[model samples]
Target chain A: MSSGLALISIFVLAVFVGFEVVSKVSSTLHTPLMSGANAIHGVILVGAIIVASHSDNTLQLTLSLLAIVLATINMVGGFVVTDRMLEMFKVKKKPASSDTSGEVK
Target chain B: MSRDLYDLIGLVAAICFILALKGLSHPKTARRGNLIGAAGATIATLVVFFYGDQLPLKNLPLILGAIVVGLVIGVPAARKVQLTQMPQLVALFNGVGGGAAALVAIVEYLKLGEEAAEKAGAIGAAVLIATIFTVVVGTTSFTGSIVTFLKLQELMTTRPVIFPGGRFVIAGNLVAILVCSGWVYSAADTTSVMVLMGLSALFGILFVLPVGGADVPIVISLLNAFTGLTVAASGYVLEATLLIVAGTLVGASGTILTRLMAEAMGRSLFGTLFGAFTATATAAGTADTRPVKSGSAEDVAILLNYARRVVIVPGFGLAVAQAQHTVRELADLLTAKGIDVAYGIHPVAGRMPGHMNVLLAEANVPYDQLVEMDEINPTFPQTDVSIVIGANDVVNPAAKTTPGCPIYGMPILDVQQSGNIIFLKRSMRPGFAGIENELLYDPKTTLLFGDAKASLTKVVSALKSL
Candidate 1:
């Protein structure tokens, strides 16, 4: 197969994988899940870096640099915020289980 | 690094992303999953630098400085942002990501210049089309996310902004965007591309304008998908397999999530966007002086103290009033009194789907007590007093009873089914959808008009007195 065809195959498979992964998520996790996925696309940082390194002129360099900054924010901030949100869920787990335990007993 | 090594690392990062999404689906593994994704992102970023031949290390210092600046700005904002404001913050992050994708595409397009047209075949056309897709969709996502941010942040009106011939105006803008995209495809000129970007930005703003407050999260999710597809297109343009995989994953997942959220709200995606056009203008400003049985906090306290079962239905108002902690205190007090208390959480309770859960969880409200709509709806009929704090739209009976209203057909918490209902509201004003809830005036309902926090505080003190 040609290189383009290989890329197309990869793209199609990835789409299916993406849909399959998050298909069964419960409603409560929707916010953090969306935020987490939002951060994943922050991998655009790699694209930004490539464009920045390829820049030959001042304007090109400026734009690419700006892209890098934005992409970094998306990636770094997205993960951190998602982690923060998930942390709330983490802390509540033990206490929540204990609270329910009393009733179970 | 060898090309083979770089590609292998990219593949690893792609797998990590898939794992991250899978891990995020459940509460037990969510934080660890996010951490794994972060580690993958860190690895991918670090490896890009070592891939020597393709990446000339010329702009290394500048790029490092930019990344540091991004870290400085991004980390603190993520860390410091209140949970209540998280929806807008997510919108902001999504916007900047879209902006970055668009900029990368523009830079690549500039670098290609006339050489792009020299490649005389289908590959050339494909690359050009990908570049155009990245530019248009990325720009639209960037601006659309910003509009949603403004609406959520209350920097602008959250109501649907429709005007005379608004639909025609939006349709014309879309047509103009398509024409410009075609123009850029034919000419590959910078001017046409620039015009296309501007039109796409305008189209984004106009597209999001007609969507009401309750529907903004869906729009955000859709724009998020748009950004993802743009990244995928840029990845194709840049010949980077990692981008293609990651971007397509988010695009596909975001699309599905958007659909799920729309379903939870009982809205078709089509009706949410274009329903404004078909909707007849309801007379909004006529002050309804209809007598609601207004009671003091003491009266509400007496009602709650005697109830055997109570369900708290919270909305965006609860978040706005910063009353989650106070409400939790009240719930705990009622539990002390042997009243069975459970929170009835609407899926689209706050600005985003599952927003209320995040807000409530921050206040350390137990997860088991936070019941989903379907599980909790059946129990509302058996509950005694349902305390609605700072929430309006999610519990509005009009969602089920009134056709042609903005929230018509949306699933609401069956709060009206409770034996008695007490609303702690700021005023008699309508909900975020701009529709007055008929349930507020029903005889079974009692209104305590004040700030949710203050009203709850009074009720707590009154319950103490009892």
Candidate 2:
């Protein structure tokens, strides 16, 4: 099969997958959801690396390096920020040593 | 790595991205999901170093240096960013990602010289289409996100900046973009591609300028989707499988979220895009002139102690004051006394969706005590005291009773139905949307004028004495 055809098929199928995975998220988690999705698109860093490595001129190297730096920021910052946000939502477990009423409710 | 082996790694990375998003759907798995996504990114980044065609030796230092620089800036910024400024942070990060995608398209175009242009006619139309799409969408997302960052940070006016013939100017930009796209399809040169990117960027700034401050959440979500599509376009150009899947996933999900945000505000997507909520002229002259009762912290405490049940409505003001901890303490005190205490959270309460919930969760408030607007609205009639903290528009009765009001038809917490309403606000200044809240003017509601943290602390102290 042609590379274009393969890409098109993957693109169409991924759209459904994206919708299915995100639709199950509750409203209370929308902020984290946005952050997570933001990080996923940071995959562009791969493309930046590719173009930057092959750059033969100063202009090409500069543009691609800028892309690399920006893409790295998007990837690293997006995931770290998302993780920080999601960590706050974890359900707290009571300490085993506490004898008093430590019930969450 | 060989080409086939590289393809295998890409496939595995794509699956990891899918699993990451799946894990994020539930709070219990969200943190783990984020880690999984990061792992996927790490794998993809590693694979780039092993590309068989590009030896990777020449750019190895540059790539590593760039990664280190990004970590230096992104990590500290993300860690230190206040929860209140999360929207701006997200905008900044998202903008950089879009800028990266646009740069990729530009470098690709510049690399394709006159010799390659003549040979490119046989490479298939898909590549050309993807290149054009990447440049247009990517540049638009880049400029649009920067403007959004400025607006959210208050460095620029949050109000809409519409001028005469604005629509025509935006329309002209779009038409020029179409012409440029056609030009690239035929000529396939760097100049045409640059022109396309510049025009799209201009349109992006104009596109977001007309949106009001209160409606920024929807705009942010929309731009998030745009960045995703741009990445997907670049994925097509690079023939990278993981980018295509992950990008499409983000694009679809962000679009859905943007639409849902508009609906949560009781506005259609069309209305949100064109009829932005706060055009200064339209919302003017709807002054709510009427007598209102005022109360002290002691009075509010007395009312709360005697009340059978109490519901608290938390809004952006609570987050701004960083009073979630105090509010949670107050609720704990009320709950221990056997007086019912529950929170009412509006869908669009804070600067971003679910922002209020995240703030309360950070305070260790039991999730069960936090009730959504739909589920809590009916219970208001049975409550004795409804304490509204730093909230205005979400509890305003004008949304329901006033016909011509700007926020009419937007669903709000039914605080007015309760026997007594106590509002904690700095003054009678209208909400972000600049609509005068009629609920504050109602006789049943009493205003408590003070900072939310100080006011809530006083109320907690007064309740303790009783």
Candidate 3:
């Protein structure tokens, strides 16, 4: 197998495992997980953009630019929204009270 | 321009992904971790676009158009969905990822041509694997998630909708899927592979149908894992760095979640899948025809006000009626009159574990006031009133000693220990597991049958007048 082909094959197989995994997360964590995963999707954007910048072909260039912007938004927006929601879990610190878990310790 | 830059970006992206995952374990830094990871991913994608020579750049509008379409749907969906609805939304999004991966793989395969399919043997293997995974999981998630959404939203019954020959249908679909998967594994023709994908899609739908609403969390988790795998496969087909990392992180996290969900229900992953239909069969021993001892809300409120110590137990009905804030107000008013008020939270209360606690916490209920089932159960006898709000299963006494009861072995809140029990509900409805709550008809129990929000509000108003 060619090195390039091997890389692609590994990538494809990894995705197969990826699908099976995401379908099984706990409900308590979906929002947080999605927010985190969306940021990771930016890696795709960065890679696509990098490919486009160096490519002489118009197709690669356009795909890369488009991927970059979408990836950025998905990543950034996901985080912002997730953070806002997580705030609901945050315990506002009381003076001289340092309880984090808020479980009555 | 240098190769080192791309490598550096990839390394950074990996680190970000790891840190984000770690941060996600704890709620505090999870959002920041998610953002940082996303940034790293964006950088990684940019680096790859610059360095990768294989990216197709010809269809300029196509790429932009896809992004635009994603935005139009994604933005509104994210904005409008409530936190409670996040699970289904995530399922929908994950399905989209798998579908996208499958589409990308198919496009790539067609582009490579019949001549290259054999010439680029290893590439063909990758494409075949990625395309097959993406299509199967994507189609499954799309259908299964829609079903889950319907169940959660009450558009469909929570009961196990068993058909006369459900198992045979599912078995047949599974066999066909296995044969198709085996053929796809051998690098079959693109058209035939696509046809196989259709069979897998049908299989996914049948696989989820027998599963009752009680197992939705597990189903959702499994579907999420499928989506991650599909995205990773798409990454392989596209040869993109971002897709690979993103897919791996999602895949890893999703797998962990599936394992956790199985654990939450005290079952193994395969056990849950193979015997998922058992939840329906288990419904046979449940109490469905039990009657509730109904009372007026005003009378129940008066009784609660007269009590010296009152414990409030909130359930899915409270969440469904959006009554947390009202219940909180009731607690405060009772407290003002020298009543010791506390909330009894069952472990497996509501749709998910700790769901009641989350809702109560959202209403600013003091942590000290919220007691777990174990601690509060023993204290129930000392309490004067135990008020159940939109709850059924957790208070049922059948879970204790009634071996034939469906929830026999499961621990429940000891509302039965209270001298006076008031249950606030909209109707004499059974819980998600379709089990009758024996406590509802107990001699000590008085059901204030009404919508949780209105009932709680009325109770608060009555307490205020006192």
Give the number of the best model, judged by lDDT: 1
Judged by TM-score, which candidate is best? 1
Specify the poorest-scoring 10-residue window by lDDT in model 2 chain A: A96-105
Tens digit of per-residue lDDT, candidate 1, span B1-466: 7889899999999889989989998888898889888988898898888876654577999999999999999999999998889988999999999999999998888778745567643337778889988998999889999999999998998899999988888889988988887888787667888898898898889888889999988888888888888899899999899999999999999999888888889999999989888889754445777888989999999999998889999988898899999999999999898788899899988888888888998888987788888888888778889999878889988788778888889998999889999998998888888888888779999999988998899999999999
The better candidate by lDDT, 1 or 2, is 1
> Tens digit of lDDT per residue, candidate 2, span B1-466?
7888998998888888888888888878888888998999899989888875757547789878988888898888899888888888998899899999999988876776543766754444777788888888888888988998998888998777789878889889999999999998777667788789899999889999888777777887888898999898888888888889889989988888777677778867777678743333564346666777889999999999997788999988898999999999999898788777889999878877788877888888877777888888888888889999988888877788776565778899999999999999988888766677877878888899989999999999999999
lDDT of 3: 0.63
Q: Give the per-residue lDDT of model 3 (tens digit) for B1-466.
A: 5667765766677667767766665656665666666566555644543554444444445455655655665666666666555545555555544444444444444444444665864445656666667667756765776677677677887766677777888888878877887776665566666777688667766777666565666777677666666666666666654466567667767677667655654456664565545444553444456555788767887898788888888888888898888888888787777687888887656765545655666778776677777678888888889898888877777667665444555567888888899988777767776777677778898988789999888777776776
DockQ of predicted candidate 3: 0.21
Better of 2 and 3 by lDDT: 2
Second chain only: TM-score per model?
A: 0.96, 0.93, 0.87
Instruction: TM-score for candidate 1, please give it.
Output: 0.96
lDDT of 2: 0.84
* lDDT (Cα, 0-100) at B436 in candidate 2: 79
The local distance difference test score of model 1 is 0.88
* TM-score (C-alpha, index-matched) for candidate 2: 0.93
Each prediction's DockQ?
0.64, 0.53, 0.21
Residue A35, model 2: lDDT of: 86
**Which should have the higher TM-score, number 1 or number 2?**
1
Best by DockQ: 1
